[model samples]
Structure formats: structure tokens, C-alpha cells
Target: MTDLISENLQNKTGLVIDGAMATELEKRGVDTNNDLWSATALIENPEAITAVHKSYFQAGADIAITNTYQANISEFMKMGMTKKEGQDLIIKAVKLANKARVDYFRLLHKEDRDVRAAHPLIAGSVGPYGAYLADGSEYRGDYQLSEKEYFDFHRSRMQLLDKAGVDLFAFETQPNFDETKALAHMLKLDFPDQHAWMSFSIKDPETLCDGTPLQQAIKYFNIFDQISAIGVNCTTLENIEPAIKNIRAVTKKPIVVYPNNGDIYNPETKTWKANRQAETFTDLTPKWLDAGAQLIGGAVEQHPKTYNK
Candidate 1:
């Protein structure tokens, strides 16, 4: 974890990343009914997106993930946007995170003595190929595409995200070993300077959704220099501990974990079946840290109530 932190995010100990950008946006009254989800806020209400980022920063998040989880050109074209317009929106997602970080620091650090607050890092979101499908495939992860095909799907958007100057990348909620390999290889070959973390959406503690063994996947991906950390996200809370312990047994690289609010997601319905096992992120943080997650936070439920102010 210490090795993965850039010079900007000075605290290497236990950095808190912000939670669901889309959920916070919906809380702020952004309409998120379409296939585009929160990315629509980037076009319809960008300030609300930035406000979500600011709220997380104010709430003590050390890193802010840009609102590009579902931002891609293929979907934009279906919505009647040109390729250029889609690319611009992707770039705008990163800009909003930067703007929010600036505003957060300026508003909170008006005096030099308040410089104790470290500038939060921006992580460009790279949701899996299933996210573009919008059929709950991100959690399923069986894209059935070849390696080259998966690489092709990710290349353009990654280049634009890098060009937009994000401090790092967050490959969140990935479900298959093949696509994970493809994306990791893409970063190694094409975007050598960029550092990214890959978090999978697992089916159980030991297995990925595609039925690959979790230990085998981490052992292979953890060696890549560009692939900074490996772990799980968008999964149930009960599944996180066993997954983290299994990951730690295989590799010493930083483990990053951001599970969902313990709800079951139905891809066909595109809705979450809430679970009673849900615990506040604060209550779960120590357990996750003790279990071996270096970076810890919430997703889908890291709402306005989680904020301090």
C-alpha cells in the first residue's frame, strides 16, 4: 500500500476512497433512470456530480473517483451523441473531480495552518465491459469476447481518461479473469505511465463470478507493475473478509476492498435486493483493515448521511 501511493496522497497508512458517485448524485436530486445512470449527471447536472465528490472529500475521503463508471462512446452514440461529444463528456468527468478537489481544499483550507489536510487524489473509473452493456453484466462478467476484443473495447476510453490526467485508475466491479487480464495487459503495454487498481465482483469468497479461483487470479495479476493493487468491490459485505484473507495469503501487494451495502443485485431487473446484514462503513472499516485491506470504503451506500458536515 505504501508503494502504491503517489507523492500527492501523502498518507500511505489507510486512505479512504469516496463511495458511489451515482448514489450520491441521486440523493442530490439528479434523475438517474436511464441506461446512462450517473454519467447522465455529467451531461445534465455536472455540478451535482461535483457536489457529490466535494461531499465525500468533506466526509474524509482521500481519493475521489471520477463519474465515468458508465461513460463510453458506444452508449453515447445510441443516445444520439457523436463520438467527439462522448469523448468530451468522458474528459469532463475527470475535470469535475479536479474541480471538486480544488473547491474542497479552498473552502476548507483558507488559512496556511489548515494545510494539514492533504489534497485528495483523483482515480479515473474504468468499469468492466459489462457496464457498457447495462444489463447487470458488470456483476456477471461473462462477456464471451476474445482477448483482443476486450482490449479493443477498453483502449480508446482508457487513452482519453489518461489524457484527461487522472492521478490513477480504478477498474471497479470486474467479474471475469479474462477481461481482467486483458485490461491489465492493456495498461502494461499502452499506458505504461499510468497506475491502476483492479477490483473484482466475486461470486463467493474463493471464486470469481466466472468460476475462476480467486487465488490463481491474484497470483497472476499482482506481478504487473502498472496494476498497483488487487481486491474486490460491489459484492456483499460477508464475502469481503474471506476474499481479502485469501488474497493476502497469495500476494503482499496492497489489497483494496469496497463492498456494496450487503444487497443482492439482479441483472435482469437492474435493481438491488436489500439485505439485513448491512453495517455502516465506519463499523466495518476496522474489520476490513484487520483482515488485510489497505484501502477501505463503501459503495452504493456512502451517501450524504456518511458525510461529517
Candidate 2:
């Protein structure tokens, strides 16, 4: 009984680079004079999605995430996709990732192709529930079914990931802890054989949203099984290393760091430019490896160069 995902997770730490936003950008073709939303462009041409994954694989990434994060059914509803239609889109997205995995394996380990037979694992990404029934300010408001809404959302998508044969299932950019925890449990229940990873978004102050200390989050998350790793994502590059250090101080579990490129603001373009210097990001890679970081990679706006550098 060989567990491919857990085997990869047990090995020495490796990079888990980001690709969705870049895939969207490349597919959308950003114009300097005009800002664009990544969704519309990706829906039109998914090859942009495939190319991004291949680049990460070539850059030494050990895992690649499919472009199915925000492609969830609920999120798709916002973009006018029915539940069936969204599921179909995700199935197609995973297939594209599988194709990239085949190509990446060929490029990176051409010699080993005959031996390994498979490329790096493809992690199916489940994103935020995206249905904030209550206003942001109403954090305590009675948003009915808040827990069920999120859990059901993840469970629905997890089933699809299972059918797609994703090597791992990852829940990322979670804003709330209880909801994230629920999703984790659901994944474990559904796929006791595969691996699961959770990544929380950092508050502006670099803590969980409930003012819960970072150490508390680490302790709270320690109860689950099959959770190969945990870390911070979708935040500034500068904050990730320190945040991960704090996380490591509490748990012996593997830590993942996939911070967004950088904070961005657009005066005239009304865009958020979350790109960072690949060289500097690369410099921190060694330190992160030394800091006991078991996994590291980029989030939004991260290019293949970041990992390759």
C-alpha cells in the first residue's frame, strides 16, 4: 500500500509554488494601460493555466496547485456558473494540471521518466467559501449556517478532487479558524488515505482574525491527523519568514510559506500589484530552509522565476 502523497510529504522539504493568479494573468494578457480581472481571461483560454504549472515544475517545485482555488461552485455562482457547470470546469482544470505534471516530469527528470512514471503531486486547492452572509464588520452577526455553508462547500469540492486523483487536498487562505478546522476534518473523513494541508491568511497584524495568538493557532491545529503541513500564505513576503518562525517555535510539524508576491496598490489602474523580487525571495529560501521550514512557495502574482531563482 504505497501512499504517493504522504511519501512526498515525508521526504526533505520542497517548494510548493503558486500558479493560479499568474495563470490567469498570462491567459488574460494584462495591458499596461488597462487593468484586468483574471477570471474572465482564464475562462477563455486555459492553456495559460497549463504553461504556468509547467514553469513551476521546471523551477524545481515539488508540488503544483491546480487553478481550482477560486473556481469553486459558490465562487462560480458569483461568476454565473451553475453547480454542475462549475464542477465540470474544475474537472477540466484538474485534467490540465495532470497534463502539465506529465510535461513537467519529462522536462525536469527526463532521465528518471522511465523510473518514476509520475511527476510531482498535483494539490487540488479549495479556497474561501466566498459567501459572506454577514458583513465584515458583523463578525458576531448571526449568519445562519455559517459553519455548514463553509463545510459543505469544501466537502463538495473535495469529492471532485478525489475523482480528479489529486495527490493532495489543500485548504488555503482561510480567514476563520473554526471554519478552516471544519474543512480539515471533512477532508480527513473523506480521504483518510491521502494528505491534507491547511494554510491561514495572516491578519494585517500578522495573527489569526480572532486576535488569537499565532502560538494558539498552532496548538489548536495540532489535533488532526494526515495534516502533512501548515503555514502562512497570501500575505507580504517580508512577514512570512517571521510568521513561520513563530509557528515552528510551537510545533514540530512541517511548515509551509507561500506568501503573496507583495502588497500592491494602483492609483489610476485600480489594481493591486502583488509582485516581488525573485532574487530577494530566492535569498530568503536558504534561511527558510534553515529555519526548519518544511515547505515554501509563492501565492498571488508569483512567477516561475521566483522559484527558479
* Model 2: per-residue Cα lDDT over 1-309, one tens digit each: 144445655533454555345434543474323222343334676777777777666555667787766566665676677878878877877888888888767565555443331336778887655322212311221233466676676777788877988888777766666677677677667777777677776664257654556677777778876777788676666777788778888887788777655655342442456454433555676777777676677743333334332
Model 2 CA lDDT for position 218: 74
Model number with the top lDDT: 1
Each model's lDDT: 0.80, 0.63
Q: What TM-score against the true fold does each predicted structure earn?
A: 0.90, 0.79
Question: For candidate 1, lDDT tens digit of each residue in 39-61?
Answer: 99988999898888888877677
List the candidate 2 regions with Cα displacement exceeding 4 Å. Answer: 1-6, 9-13, 23-42, 78-80, 107-119, 131-145, 204-206, 265-270, 274-279, 299-309
Root-mean-square deviation per candidate? 3.2, 4.8
Error of 2 at 217 (Å): 1.6
